[model samples]
Target: MTYYRTYENKEDVVIQFLKTRTDRLLKQFDEGNYQNRYEWYKEIFEEILEQKEITYKILKTPQLCAVALEHFNNFAKVLLPRVYKIEGDSTAMHNRIIYQTGGFVFLMSHWVLDGCRQSPEEMAHLLDGYIHNQ
Candidate 1:
């Protein structure tokens, strides 16, 4: 029941898209902490995108890419298993990202989304369907 959402990148900087909702997602960014390591996270997302160029195959097939894009909710998980949830599964989170490029779009959730809490992989799968078929 993840209350998923999707939006076009509409910009070159990935952070802009991510920042689109930092206010609601992050507890500190509003306090100005995001600025401290903003560049780092942005670079990380960009680097992962570049290293996984093979994934771009989805872009060509918008049908498939659209399916995978649904997993966008896992964006929070991108930095999950973070300092707070250090004991959880990070690799699991990694498997959740929905890779896209340009003014690319992805998904996200309203805290707790659909009442039924979701795993990173589950989120990815939902998007995968759209990415592969749509």
Candidate 2:
């Protein structure tokens, strides 16, 4: 709290924290080279699982859930195109990205809420299956 004294409210603090965390993950994703998108997803899932407590708290909180979803949306927008060939009508592409991102977040939220019963590798494989089938 003291470190974030500049923020006027809790929402602001959460937003800033999410932005920073998302930025770091994006940077790592961008810098790393992987044989496939699954590898990238696995790495990210591992990182998130390491912080499951905090993530669960954020997802459970109504206001913070919105913030988390927004950041996840932004993160997906930047990361997805790099791994997939996303080309089409502008509106259609945007909607596709939103759905894809939302689905991924939904899976993650449920996984965290359910105590992350699946390992990160398993989660990545599941997500890969979804993406591959699409």
Candidate 3:
């Protein structure tokens, strides 16, 4: 199936997909198997915002969340391929990431942005460097 670009409502879709994906990814990460990766992402995620509360940001966090959502859906352009199992598909990125049998795990979380810090491809490159221990 071809992944169509719904540029208008893409971010909302991606946010929904990511929120859902994060829930499941947390489980895998909590387990012993992906602990390293999980911790690594958590560290990055925490470090990125310094554990600041999104609510206090006065729309910043929510705006970032919204931006992140859009980024994810736009990223679905190539992401749909790396994804192992896509039970749901949409212009929103809410249901995007699922740690299935194969594919790069970082790609999933990298897209889980708080705002437009970086592009998915850029994040993928960074993950590649990290995964290879460069």
Candidate 4:
């Protein structure tokens, strides 16, 4: 099934999708009502399946969870340098590094609101250049 585009390209659609879903997941995780990370991810992935206009064939819940986790994990790894750069110039917040996964979650919340405006692949490339050792 073809998912119609409101954005310029498939990349744009994916970027928007990631921003939206990540924002929701971040919020739910922050609320602390969920028992564990997998449970939280399960709920968010179910919501994505229900609400998003996805073109991929349906899969089992575990499969959906796997996909979501992989995407978010890649995003976190690629974006880590940017987060470190932001924090490096400041002295106000250090927790972002202490718990890297949580830091990524918080950063993703800002991404949805602030808008990265770059595609994920672009961000990953920029990250590689910025970090050098990655």
Candidate 5:
């Protein structure tokens, strides 16, 4: 049996939303054609962004765009393969990746929210390198 969490903080709420949303998108990717999966992934990503009150337009600013792009791409590449290795089936692997992705997103979001003041490019390089090296 699974126990659902009730989130009181904005960070927790956003992370929880991403956790569930990513799981659904991963399932869509598993079932969809290549093109369709990309589309579905975009739609679901947009939905989660809205739920988190995060604006793509805002994230695209020169200071932040690199971080957004790098983390988004690298997280999928690094995390998905690891989860896939651990869980054979598409569904099970995706379920695990959901939590893993959410945790990373949550930590990064907290860094941003806490006014870390690092440029997105710097953050991306630091984070992507860390994840890749690990």
Candidate 6:
């Protein structure tokens, strides 16, 4: 309510809150020492698993989906090229990134909304396979 008062409306409050959370996660990823993208993603999923309830709420909210997608897009753009050499046309590379990121977001949203039954390690492994199999 206080944030709603400060912001324009509930959606603005939600967007602000999501951005803050996403930014913090991204910052942590940047700071943490990881051997590979798998380790980086594992740490990320672990953090989200720690806040499953709040994460679920955020994912379930339709208005906030684009914000979440944007964060994933930004994360993918940085992380993917390091993991795989995506060569050829710039537009092709962009589309590939978008495709991979969208799949990741879809998997994450489903996992979180489905009570996050799999452990973070498991989710990371699954994501690893998904990325490598492409």
Best by TM-score: 2
lDDT of each: 0.40, 0.82, 0.44, 0.48, 0.51, 0.76
Candidate 5 lDDT over residue span 84-108, tens digit each: 4564447765655665566556555
Residue 66: error of model 4 in Å? 16
TM-scores of the candidates are 0.27, 0.86, 0.26, 0.36, 0.33, 0.76
Question: What value of lDDT does candidate 4 attain over all alpha carbons?
Answer: 0.48
Question: What's every prediction's RMSD, in angstroms?
Answer: 15.6, 2.2, 13.9, 14.2, 11.3, 3.2
**lDDT (tens digit, per residue) of candidate 1 on 1-134:** 22223434422223344344443344443244554343333433343344344344443455545544443445444433452345656565454332332112423222122332454445445444554554
Candidate ranking under lDDT, highest first, comes to: 2, 6, 5, 4, 3, 1
lDDT of 2 at 38: 90
lDDT of 2 by residue, 23-90 (tens): 88678767767777798789878988988998888988999898778878887778767656675437
Off by over 4 Å in 3: 1-11, 35-66, 69-133
TM-score (C-alpha) between model 1 and the true structure: 0.27
lDDT of 4 by residue, 59-120 (tens): 22445434544566665544444534453433343333334545434443333334444444
- Pairs in clash, predicted candidate 5: none
Runs in model 5 with CA error above 4 Å? 1-5, 33-38, 41-134
Ranking by TM-score: 2, 6, 4, 5, 1, 3
Worst 10 residues of 3 by lDDT: 96-105
lDDT of model 1 at residue 7?
33
Q: What is the lDDT of candidate 6?
A: 0.76
TM-score of 2: 0.86
- Give the range of the ten consecutive residues with the poorest summed lDDT in model 1: 102-111
After the best TM-score superposition of candidate 6, give how far the Cα of residue 2 lies from its true spot, in angstroms.
Answer: 4.4
